[model samples]
Structures are given as C-alpha cells and as structure tokens.
Target: MEALNQPLQVELGPLRERMGIGDLLRYERLAGIPLRRRFFVALTGVLLLAIAMLVALVWLDRTGILAQAPVLGIFAVGYAVLAAVGFVWYAIDLTRRARLALFAWVNGWAYADSLEGTRRPGSAFARTLRSRERGVVASDDERLPFELGRNFSIGTRDWGATVQRPFAFVELPLPVKVPHIVLKNRRRSIIPTLGLGRGGARMELEGEFAKHFLLLVPEGYQQDALYIFTPDLMARVIDLGAGAEIELVEDRLYVYLPGGTRFDRPATMEATLRLAEEFQRRFAARTELYRDDQAGDLAARAGVAIGLRGQRLAGSGVSLMAVAATAGVLLLSAGVTAFSLFGGDLLRAWGAG
Candidate 1:
C-alpha cells in the first residue's frame, strides 16, 4: 500500500487540525463515508450529552432552587467549551488514522485499520502472558518505511502487577546470525522488565555504551554477542533509540517503543525509522541469508539437570572421569599382551633358578 503523495507537515497537519467545513469537504472527498461516519458518531454522543444537560436545567428551573437565565447561559457556554474539546479530540483521532492510512499508501506499504486478523501467526506480537495482557487494543501497522507493528497492549511483569506496555516496534533483520540479546537503558528503569529481564547472562560493554545500558546475551555466546554489538553499532544504537530497548531474538531485531504507535508524534516516528534504517544499513553485509537447511534442533543439544561431577561433562553424553578410566584400562591390557609374548625367556630363567 502507498500513501498519497502529500506534504505531511505543510498539507496534512494543518488540514487535520483546521476546523473549517471546507477541510471536511476535502476529507470527505478523500476518505468518502468513513470520515463522515466518525463525525456522526461523535456528534451523536455530544447530542445525547446535551439533551441530558437540557433536562437537568429544566428540572432546576421547575424546582426554583436556582432561577437565573444568566446562570444557565454561563453554564451552557462552559459546557460548549468542554464539548468542543471532546469533539476536537475525536476529530483529531479520526484524521490521524486517515493520515496514517494515506501515509502508508504513499510509502508503498500495506496498512490496516486494526491489528486483528492482520497479525502474522507465530509473530512476537501475537504471543502474550495472560495475566499481563490488555484486551483488544487499537492497532495500525504499516509494512512500508519499515516493518513497523503495534500490538495495543504488550503485557509486562511490572511490580508484581500486569502492566500494559502499548508498544510500537520496527523490525530490523540482521545479516549475521546472532544469538538473542537485549540492550536496555539502565537509566530508564531500575528493572529491565520489557527486555524480558536478565534471562541469561548480563554483560556490561566497554566505554560510554556500558554507562548507558545493560546488555544480556545467551550463555556461551558472549564473544559472538560482542562481535555483533561493536562499539560503533552500540554507539549508533544509543544515538538512535529515544530511550527505548533494543531486543534481538533470533533473526528479528526489534526496536521497542514505550507507548502505542499512534501516540508517537511525527518527529518521534521519523527518528525511530531513521535509527532502524541506519542499523540495518550498517549490518547489511554481515547478514546471512535465511535458508531452511540452516535450522537446527539447538534446544535438544543444550545441557539439562544438576550433576555431581557430571556438570563438568554436561551435553557431551559421557563423563571426563569415565573417559580417563577407559583409557587407563586400554593401556594396561596392551602392556599385559606385550608381557605375555616377551616373558618366554623370563619363564625359562625362573625355572633354572
């Protein structure tokens, strides 16, 4: 899908926040019935609230507790201001969706009004921890510019309660096959909950990068992890991230934003995309092309269970002590065979004695 070629700041921004019927005509022409439907829905809600207010005013008048037309006029004016605020908010929300839809189209990306039925199966966004999940959130994901997706409520284990992290993510596919790693800004939160916490080993990198973030990587892959996160890359990550976490799980490198995608102003969106693009560009040569043959049952091979001395030989299926003992027996048997053949002269000497 592609958004129509329009200057977003010069054209789209003003037209949206503008409150003239002329702008509605433009919106109606572009969006047709959808824009109108939203307006009517908001209008209906305000109308009902107005009716309730009117009834209250009539009740007050009949009771003679408060008599004045002037008092009611002032209250009506205040209510109108409140109603305008509500209407403006509703209009802005609707217009933004329309803008985003068009924006996606212009950029040669697909756009969906919501994430439901659009979410790819087995995607990270589709999985959630039940207790932390927030139900059915509004989502608008576009494929163009980047694989940017938002799942309304990404659940987290926050302070022993289920917290909704309405997250927006830009997926960066790395050229190299790197183990899952997470780099979270230490200054942002005391606990790196959204980085999925410290799952394996927490690594502190060298230089200013180390000062800003705590890196977590899988066991035995510390060197490989370091290779991927070079000082330059780390610097770029820090420079680009607007204080969000960078999570690398398998091939998918996710730049996780704190709030819903819609909450991002245009500037934030631009910065995020810019950062993701830069990272992708720097790592393009290193990225390995995906193939089904490359897949392996790595989990089946990792060690499990506690061991006495066995921990030393884990994942090898045999103990180091067993190998040593077996070698010792083999050497002894070979010596005995040599002695049997060579002892003939020794036996005769012993008989003479």
Candidate 2:
C-alpha cells in the first residue's frame, strides 16, 4: 500500500515552459537514491580528472604553447569519452527501470528494484549460487511470478572465477516434489573438466531432441522424467532456445542462458519471459496438488516470510566413473614404473640369449 502511494510516475519526459507550481508538484519531489548515487560517482570522477589535468598542465611547461593543442586535445577526448559512457549508462539504466515498472504494472503485480522481503537462508540456490545484488522480484499476485535479475555472478575462482549472466525464471509450484532433471546442448564442451562431464544417469527422450540435447535425470526418476517432459513439451523447449540449458530441480523449471548475455534489450527479455511462461503452463497440470499447500496459505494469512526456493539440483551427485578413471590412472602409472625398473635386466637377458 505504501509503495503504491509513495509516488505515481517516473516522469522522464519534459515539455514545460515556466511550469506552474501544481504541474511541478505533481512529479515526484526527489529521484531515487540509486540515481543520486550514480550522479555523485560520475561527478567525483570528472572533478578528479580535471584537477589532474590542471596539475599536469602547470608541471609540463617544457612543451611550449605549440604543443598545448595536442596535450589539451588528449584531455578533452578523455573527458568526452568518460561523459559519453556515463550518459549511455544513465540512459540504459533509466530505460530498464521504466520497462520493469511497465512489466509489473501490466501484470498487476508489485515491483521492487531490489529483492522484496525474501530471505531464504536454508536454500542453497539463493544462499550460495545466485548473487544477491539488485535482484528484482514481482510477487503479491495470484500467479506468484518470477524474479528477473541482470548481472548475476556465480562460479568459483578456479572455474573461470566470477562470471556474470542474466537469469530470468519463474518458479513452478509443484505440489508433489519431483527429482532433478537437466537438458544440456550436446555439441559444445560447456563445462571445463578433465574428461567427460558426468551429469547423472542420462535420460534419452524420443524424436530429434536427442540430436540436439542430452537429458540427464536422477536414477529413480527416469520414468517420471519422461512423463513430465512430454513429446510436445520437448519440442516447445527446443523451439524456446537451442543454446539454452533447461533444468528441473524439485519444482522449479530453470532456463540458463550462456554467461555474458544481457537482458536489457526488449527482445531478449521477451524471449526469456515467453519460454518461461510456456514451461510453467505446460507443467501446471502435471504438478499434483497436495494438502500441504494449506500451510503456505496459513502462513500467508499469518504474514510469515517466504524463503527462496533452493534450485541447486542436489548436484549431479558426483561420478563413480571419475573415481574409476583415477584408479585406472594409478594402475597404469604402477605398470610404467615396473617396466622402467625391470627393462635393463630383461634387455641384458635377451642379448645374452
């Protein structure tokens, strides 16, 4: 209620000539804190650069008046580039905020520039996997929509360090929990591993799906996985994005795009949202409703906080093949050492014979 009442418009446009007090008062009195912070940072950078240029100009007097043009031109170009970059960033961010607002408004859901009161400590996905910086979620609607985040960084220092990616997903409310399932592209070596990257027991689906993607599911859930991802759904998923990887952990359907993809563009956002929405709709009937949902309903009535859903896939759960390979390596090493030690004696015996 308070968020809605706070201020009505973003008010980016202007066509005023000595605007009246009433017209001026209608717009929000103050810009948001983030805009102010950005302005301050840019201002500080320009000021520091100007001071440095002035000091350099005084100290480097040997250049004479003739060389001043080139030197001044360098400084001017530097400043211009900095200012242009700042302006571009400002324009992009402002447009992004407006689009987010429009998305929330059209869907009749509340929007926040940051996470909205969701603190899921127990969940490994939110607590560990995804970054918590400037995540936006739209909830308070019947649909219980998705959280779209830009520049979410995840990964270890060893595995290419911190990689930023755009993640857009909607949580599928599964009444009966399901096993983890993943569909990855087959062509490229997506993961950096010594040998083959094991992703649990491979669940091969019918038709052309196998040609493009390799589906992996937990041991017990192969049959259920087949049933869950029907032939029609498989075709639709393929159509969604050929390069993207789709994952199912418990209840959530996640479409993970390659790292370094940006969601600021309308086309990108549209495609992401369209695919996610399709998945949600397709899986709706399959998720069997349970009486346990009432606990959530009761909590909602009681105003209890909701934790973030853990989408860590329980992992591929490691591989016995990897351990087997390691053992094989050790045996080969031992055999090589034995040959190295015994070769002299064997060679001498053969010559004597």
Question: What is the RMSD of candidate 1?
Answer: 24.7
Name the best candidate (by lDDT).
1
The residue pairs that clash in candidate 1, if any, are: 1-109, 2-105, 2-106, 3-102, 3-105, 3-106, 175-286, 175-287, 175-288, 176-287
**lDDT digits (tens) for residues 85-140 of candidate 1:** 88988677656655555555554445554444434221234333431211111213
Residue 296 error for model 1, in Å?
7.4
Best of the candidates, TM-score: 1
The Cα error of candidate 1 at residue 226, in Å, is 0.9
lDDT of each: 0.53, 0.51
Off by over 4 Å in 1: 1-37, 64-84, 117-145, 154-160, 175-177, 189-199, 260-269, 286-353
lDDT of 2 by residue, 42-76 (tens): 55676676677666665555566427566675675
